[model samples]
Target: MNRPRSTCLAVALVATILFQPGARAQVTGAQVRDAIADAVRHLKARQQPDGSWRSRDRYEHGYTCLATLALLLAGEAPTSPPMARALNVIAHAPDEYTYVVSLKIMALAQADPEKYKEDIERSARWLMRAQDESGLWSYQLNPVNYDHSNSQFALLGLNAAAQAGVKVPAGVWQAARRRVLTTQNSDGGWSYTFRGSSYGSMTAAGVSDLLILGGAVVSPVERGVRNGVAPGCGRYREDKPLLNGLRWLGREFSAIQNPGHGRSNLHYWLYAVERCGILSGLQMLGRHDWYREGAAKLVSDQRADGGWGTIENTCFSIMFLAKGRKPLLVQKLQWSADDDWNPDRNDLEHLLDRIGDKLGEPMSWQSVPFDAPLERWLAAPLLYMQGHKFPEWTPNQREKVRQYVEQGGTLFLEACCGREDFRNGAEAFLAETFPLTPLHELDSGHPVYHAYQDVAPAGLMGVDVGCRTSIIYSPFDLSCHWEQANIPLLGERAFDLGLNIAAFATGRRPLRDRLDLVKVAEREDINEPPPPGDPLVLAQVEYHGDWQPDPHALAHFAEYLNEQAGLRVAASARATRLTPEELPRAPFLYMTGHYAFELSGKERAALAAHLRRGGFLFADACCGRREFDASFRAMLRQVAPQGELRRLEPTHPIFSGSPGFRIESVGYRAAALAENPNLSRPELWGLETDGRLAVVYSPYGLGCGLDGHACYNCRGILEADARRMATNVVLYALTR
Candidate 1:
């Protein structure tokens, strides 16, 4: 079940150093978006007046179907004029050729499966009838020979049709799987025809075809019976042919050209690669980051007209980028025996499918080995780890897991079959990894319970890392329930909880195709030491109760200052106590927490003395907690008895763009805006002493926003506005 230790260790080291923040790819998420938009515009402009695109004379119907599928996958609405016209053409098209019929079925199924169900079913029947006696597909019915390309498309079309509630015969899948296994070359690759040598396009086609056929035979719902204790539980081990084919594809991988056949039908090959990678649920093919490399190639290869060579090629490239760039929802941790970690093979897939349906967007998931590098681990926002037995990890592995979680990754642990041993082991692992923070049972009021769907409490426990609960644990059998076809009431609750967890972890933000680039930019600014000079040091005041509720907020805000105002600031804030010795080193002191706290008289006197020395004090309630807000306001009263805290006017320097961004109005989070829709202008309070803005405070949360992530049900200013406000305040403080 586990890879050889030497191989795993070597790959881990190389992956770690290669994908480090400093060595991120040059292509960014913005550039990819621009390229996609350009391609979309090109396709729109190229649409024929008759609502069909013609590439080759004889295969115009197939070309049109390809174009329509590409556009639809790229987020084109079916009701749009271009898509409506295209759909109309496809709906009324003849089903004479196998290629055209297969493409038409896929397009219609994706466009509006329910609305075009009959068309999809009819096309699927045509494809099923066209299958050769040897369980392969050719250009049309009664063909002498069958090719891998045609067979792959036929299976893809049928799969889409099946997903749209069509009942595909099991015999069709069984025969196809058998033939695909038998035809695999000695070198593990596949050829266009049985007599020819293997190449990239055909290999991809072969691998994807097997995956489709295999998945159909042993569906997600049927996978529930494994449950780790059943006979033949090692399903992955049994898939030797699939594994061999993957190894071949990995060995001959390329995004620039079809391997072994340079530049010939490269777009078609890339499309096949996308399908293979997606179906296998893998981020890497051997060592290549397939999506990243492929996206970069496609973006660079685009012509001035925003197309790639021919219309068919353009459509293929578009589909590759559109479908391949889907955000990763979760990565199931592959640790221990494969059966132990993934008893129910399709649990994450099924859960993601439901989540995708709810969001009206495509979501992806993958299985990542626990020994994988930190970069690979951080690719997805959430890491889902489930097992029926205790996970015995080495010291190095444990440390790596700790690093991943601390650096903005959410860990979701579940005990399969409600195993007490796994639950206890998970608790111990969490305790060891985060000694300072212990897992506590989450209450019904916690955000995870209501992030999306409001569900009753199911005894979920979590560990608070910085401003959010980064580690969540469930001592129950959720994965088994997820694998059920017609989920029971308890299974429905499990899905609801899974949805909420995903929403909380991702904040419903679109994950970039290349998240490493963004992470690198942020890390270089926030984690790297400042230049050797007199840099402004933003210090956090250590206090009685949960003062460092957002441990990363100050550093992230310092990064904002460096980026926005060209300020020379320390990469990390210094945590200082309220004493004379430590107070003078930091002219700007930040104070924030979640719980109510009273300052000792000595601490109060020290703060008052610091303010007398012209030092600035800025504070905000973490997560807009009422206890902290009230306590902070009271502390200000006691510290400066004569000064009254007053709301800063819109004309105040912080709001009037004295430092940088103008802030006449700001956007609030949904929870905050729900209660105060009319809230617009900044609502910051200031207490002046000797006509200097000695103290500035916000009752609403700012730290969570400064951390550059959303907190479900958190009442706060949005990230952009909060960053702007923080920058203006820091600039004003330094000058005043």
Candidate 2:
């Protein structure tokens, strides 16, 4: 909840606030929402009854499409009256103009891709046909006049269409890339027309287009600034033309108007500024918030009737405030085998979902055959391969995987159900690939365990090792547990493990420091009561049935909290059944079991009261099974119907913030992977009362992940990960 906002106000035209040390404070999400609401009301009032906005002769289609997009960005549902009206106009209009066709394509793609797929593809075809020989687009369908303004919109539409499943020619993107590269002036900025004097608006548009087309701009100076260098900032430079253009924009940054054109194209300039900053992933431009500053100007400049006038100006202003650009997904690879590498042994869907959830962005997954050109896999930051027996790679394939690992690409290998072939083949491959840097055992001390969550080693199974080159190998079957029931269900620790591996592979170790952690205190007095006011003491909850599957689990976790997080606690976990008398002193109660059990009326009342009194109950099943999972849900319903178990959002504080940890379960059902490979990803569930987490539950047997204890024929999260989750839960409960 206290996350620093990444929003940046517009560049300096309207904003006079100079950048200074400790001067930056993020605009909260709530502020952005309020501004959007006002903008949306203004747009709605300006809409025509026919769902179209007034436009220049023959440009009504284009204006309507643009306005529709703006409304969508302002949180208008696609089916809303205004959006539907605009879509209807687009659907019926004879979209002959190049700009109209292009804008229509984008609007439809965003509004309802499936329902309007045919229209989108047809418009896309028209756009491709309308392009001039110079690989640029003009406003007119076949006009010789071409400029970056028209070209940028065309490219934007094409990109949107491509994502909506419209097949765009590979050559289209290639040719566009070439055109932008050739048009760049020596000064690293573009003009309205190629080779013309450089200007701010056109430069931003140019950079955005190039980035969209996958062109890298070199920054002439580090941080893309030159003159107004923040004192003490280090000097570093990458001389890409794109970077150069950004530097020029930063230097002449303005939210009020186009620096070169002045107020002539103010709204247009703001829209281009939004695209450039967002596409480049820069929150600040030369110490300015391009978005925040631009938004403030637009809000203040709005006409009394809520329209910026000229229809075009209003549309552009809405677009700028909406910040309407989706983050591009980084390419990723999943190495494939001809036979065994398939539906069941795959965690591609789960992995992407986890990455999206954890990173708060979307990710696209691509599959590469085992024998595909090594160059193919090299482009991705992470490559996943899991099977019972990894097919022996051709010598070339072997060399490729090696090079990939050495060149900072990560290769994740998990044996299928502890398959001998996979384990043996993987080890052999490692031996041949890196004879000098042999695979060494990975202990709890490794950076990977504590990358996101503080992980404790439970020695789940087999030998897990890591090489210096961001390479990690697990002989156990990790995918199976993740893909159980085709839905990820192992545990948070399991998900955390997978996410940490991916993050590390991508060179993003947000939680990099491996804290000088001490083992948890396992010295809780089993029979004695806690001393008065021992606020941080952990209590073990005992119930009937197969509880205490891992008798020392709670104690191990309590010790982890004390040692890693420095929380004061009893030497060991205290055990007590559901009793009002026994529960008052402990604010945190931990429980787990492998079988179903019923709670008596008195026990139910006691449990309910404990939770209502600010007590936190954390529980997990010993083995992921229907019986225990069902019973656990039933018990929660009986204890607190309104607080029945529900899945925790990936962004929940428990997953981030205080403990900021994640974990994953490894291994799988021998034949289950093949049977259901498209299930929903695993999740963590909790019961809440008064907006505070009252109970934390995991279907996966987290107990098995403690103390290297193995459950009877059940897979558990690795010890390191289990302990990490344990630490996080304690931290979350105490702090949140």
Each model's total of backbone clashes: 0, 45
Candidate 2 lDDT trough over 10 residues, lowest sum: 1-10
In model 2, which runs have C-alpha deviations exceeding 4 angstroms? Answer: 1-28, 215-239, 303-305, 324-736
Clashing pairs in 1: none
lDDT of each: 0.79, 0.63
Top candidate when judged by lDDT against the true structure: 1
Candidate 2 accuracy as lDDT: 0.63
Candidate 1 lDDT over residue span 511-610, tens digit each: 6564344342123222344458889988888987898866667877888888778998887788888988879887899999888899999999999999
